[model samples]
Target: MKEYKRFLLYGLVVGTVIGFYLIFNLKSFVSYENIFIDKTDFMLSSRLIIYNKTCGLQHWKEKKNFGHRDDIPFFSILSTILSSTEKKIIIIEFGANVGQFSERVLSIPHKIPYIVHSIEPVLTLFHLLRNRSRTFKKEKNDKHFHYNLAISDQSGEKPIYSPSQYGEGSTLGKAFLSNFKEIENVTVTTLPEFIKKYHIKTPISFIKIDVEGFEPEVIRGMNLSINAKIFPLFSFETGETWLDDRSVLAKEYTLKSFVEMLNYFQYDSYFIGNPYLLPISGTYWKNSFDGLRRNPNVLAILRHSQPWKNLKKLLNRIPFTSC
Candidate 1:
């Protein structure tokens, strides 16, 4: 009887510890600002000044490049487009892992008033984004905003695959590389739902999506924004393998289907680093897949946008290249 009692006691203690741990994690997951980090957070990287620390084994040596700088040209174009309009600019970034792109957008000088909704689904990465956002706030800069949830076609729970490459291959679908070792179930919210919930009244001017292979579902969730004709300029990542799977989303939202949907909305596409914008009826559709895999980041422009006309003038000053 004593032995059994001791065994029960041990089991109770172990269970209590696990329960506490889970509660703590849940609290942190819901409130990203609770674990925010700032200038005094890191011990090293003092003189040279580095950005957010990554999830790699050797954090000291990991390259801090998050492709934030690459989006500067796009922002410049948006600035020119909104030069005269008094419409409040809102930038929605779907896969804002570590807040790098958000940092670039917020840190730079803006010609017009803008707000950024930087959303990250993964709990671990969301914390990193909040920490980076806090750092930005510490500098007396306050344009960057952070959200801790996934944006999908529905608002519920979905399994997210986390690969061994840290933030490199996490996705809501199982189409990730075979080397993924962790699977996390994350809460999801749609764009219109989020906008309504947050009372965001401004029009979205730009969006950068890098959600592995989950961009199509993200697009579907933005039907409200699309139908309202507030279609924002998009910088999206595309690849052949993203649609190669037989998943329901892949089957329905195939590359051709998505392009057609964009056409229905009167969006013209262009390869970034190219001076010329591909017309809505151009032959660029045939090479979209090839361009997607090789270059990945394609710019989608609204064909009838008055701002696009002014933005096109600036593109002429820059060199054109095929992506």
Candidate 2:
């Protein structure tokens, strides 16, 4: 009888301890204050705000040759065209660093059979792109191709600077300081050569050119006549700074020159940003150019004709201004 009473006492103590533990821990789980402080206050308030704003919706978190922003207007316009049209789209991306833009392009909703051809001169970056292309191809089935070559005015490989020490696929021309070595000299070819090689007689939908400071050379190599055949859209990167040097060009390439060059092909050009038009006195250009040269960040979109009218309308719906 005494032993039974002792067992009952022991059971009561264990039950009380278990009850207290449950009350303390489980209370925190169900408490409104806990939810407010832990999940709502921290996760939603702190982390989500910056991550969603900068990376998730803004799409600027990734390390791209061009700093991140929302999707490029030209790409958005091209996606709209591809979504609407029955024609196959071919995108040739020059200086494709880690296939960031190519990945974004494939993500757009479209039924048009699209082929993305990416060219990267740097060996390490080419390997990264090759791997990414394989993964993308495995998922999508024959949608992308990667090549290791430097696109120049003529065919024949030249000295390529592979700065593996930088640890990023995309490096500004001035940022490359790694050891120089002889990489397989894949002869540079023009856009026409690419089209012929691929048997892509269809209308070329888009061409994204970003070869650091070598933009002019790539432009000169391409046959603009082919542009007439396909009405291809171009998005090239240019800056006032020469390769690997912060020293500004003596005579920098101006928007006016770019406009004149494209105008020769009857392509109307417009600068994409808050101020739709270039400033009258070129003060804006001088300041912005200097700012970007020092910081090495800034992206401007050039489109054929006023293709961004729809985009401008869309931007008006947003509460904030663009960079």
Q: Cα-based RMSD of the predictions, in order? A: 25.9, 17.6
TM-score of 1: 0.66
Give all TM-scores, in the order shown: 0.66, 0.57
List ranges where model 1 is wrong by over 4 Å.
1-74, 82-87, 137-141, 165-167, 175-177, 224-228, 244-247, 251-257, 274-281, 288-291, 319-323
In candidate 1, what are the lDDT values of residues 14-59, reduced to their tens digit? 9999999868844532342212222473334111111111121122
State how far residue 64 of model 2 sits from its true place (Å).
16
User: Candidates' lDDT values, in order?
Assistant: 0.59, 0.50
| Worst ten in a row by lDDT for model 1 | 48-57
Q: What is the C-alpha local distance difference test score of candidate 2?
A: 0.50
Best by lDDT: 1
In order of listing, the candidates' clash counts read 0, 2
Tens-digit lDDT string for candidate 2 (196-265): 8867654556677767566656666775645553534565554443445421331345544544566566
